[model samples]
Target: MKLDVTRRSREAMRAYLAEALDGCYEGEPTISPIEGGRAAAERQLSNFDVRRYASRNHVTRGHVSRMSPYIRHGVMTLREVRDAVFARFGRVGESIYKFVFELAWHQFWQEVYAGLGDEIYADIEDYKFPPPVWQETLPDDVARAETGLVCMDEALRELYATGYLHNHARMWFAAYLIHHRRVHWSVGERLFFAHLLDGNPPPNALSWQWVASTFSSKPYYFNRQNIEKYTDGTWCRQCTAACPFDQTYDALAGQLFGNA
Candidate 1:
């Protein structure tokens, strides 16, 4: 079989991406946010010890692998990444299990896309709970990252700047957009796809649906307490907004889903 590839210098690639993504980004990304190519991916894979995987959700700790872009764009394959993990850690027991499971999630989303085609963009099943009214357009506050909710705005800024977010951050953002803002899940889905380097349609859309309660048993909502606990109260201390998320889950559910 014949193979073809296009390669560009780092400067040329950066300029092209900046121009191509022009207005879609809110701010300039970190310099060399991440590198591409197989070598870089392999290096990242090699660094994936099991200790970090165990603490991946700590926003303060921030111990993610940061290799989704490579996997998404085919710079590396899931099989190779998995084999590398196994080679290092030996069997698929507790130590390497979580990391492997994360890899499996990527493959599961891909398999769903392969089976469902474009239908992944639509709701996969009836919503278990009533969702708020759906707005087709992305809210200006969200797009501009001026939502006043400190954690959310910060997460949006990070996404715009890095083309990536921690999975927990992504879930919180999606839940806020769908359940709190009442924007349609599709609107947030498209925005994420536009900004994320690892933005594959199936995972993005389905995950948004999961947050929105269309693909899961209930909508996902988070409060200020949870944010404070995970993010070390960084966003909360400096926040000026009225803090809509201060309420309990029941209070939020009541306010968000009143008589629906």
Candidate 2:
């Protein structure tokens, strides 16, 4: 089971895995361009400035730490990350709250899964919206990033090529699939599990349910303005597709949930 890294270049390692584990995986054989191992993890952590993170982490090209793969795989622990942040910035402040809350959020999902086990696969609560007429599978257009919506298409393409999507994009895609497209939350959850490098059931599945309004008080949907604000209009500027997200929140709510 040991990979002999002594002689292989990164590309060679990727090729080796693709050949060795062929048919064991889906899609093209790929490795994240993000490097692995403790040294790389330490370097990423060292470069992460909590100050910049607090202000920009929600945006498309934000100052995210890029430590997700490492933390997800245990190359870095949540405690280690928290301690690292605390060492640099004091634990008690608005600056650290968002970043810390993210860590805690992941941990909270883990705890929920631990307690509920396979029950997490079922609805934890009823949808806050009307009963959904749900599709059980990811659509071909979506799987291939041909949805014609720039944001969703780009997010899917990013996931296919790099095995990563920004958190904002993930939420948007989930909401789109579940609400706009009438696909089940589990369908998008499985799509993410199949592709995301940091895909872990507790957060991935639960977050999808939360967005689908099966595990939260309401569904989470976003408007074009919200996307433009967070992405700085990057996708919208180039996007020629008729935007499903162009409506106001009230309009979206009625359109998506009124008939439930």
Give the winner by TM-score: 2
Candidate 1: worst-modelled 10 consecutive residues by lDDT: 1-10
> How do all models score by TM-score?
0.88, 0.93
Q: Which residue pairs show backbone clashes in model 2?
A: 130-260
lDDT of 1 by residue, 15-71 (tens): 676777778655553435678789889888777676657778878676778889999
Residue 104, model 2: lDDT of 91
Displacement of residue 103 (Cα, Å) in model 2 is 1.1
The TM-score measured for candidate 2 stands at 0.93
Give candidate 2's root-mean-square deviation (CA, Å): 2.1
Residue-level lDDT of model 2, residues 1-260, one tens digit each, is 45677856887788888888988988778787888899999999999988877655455768887788898999999999999999988888876888998889989999999999988888899888777678998899998899999999998889888988888888999999988999989889888998888888889999999998888988999999999988889999999999999999999989999954
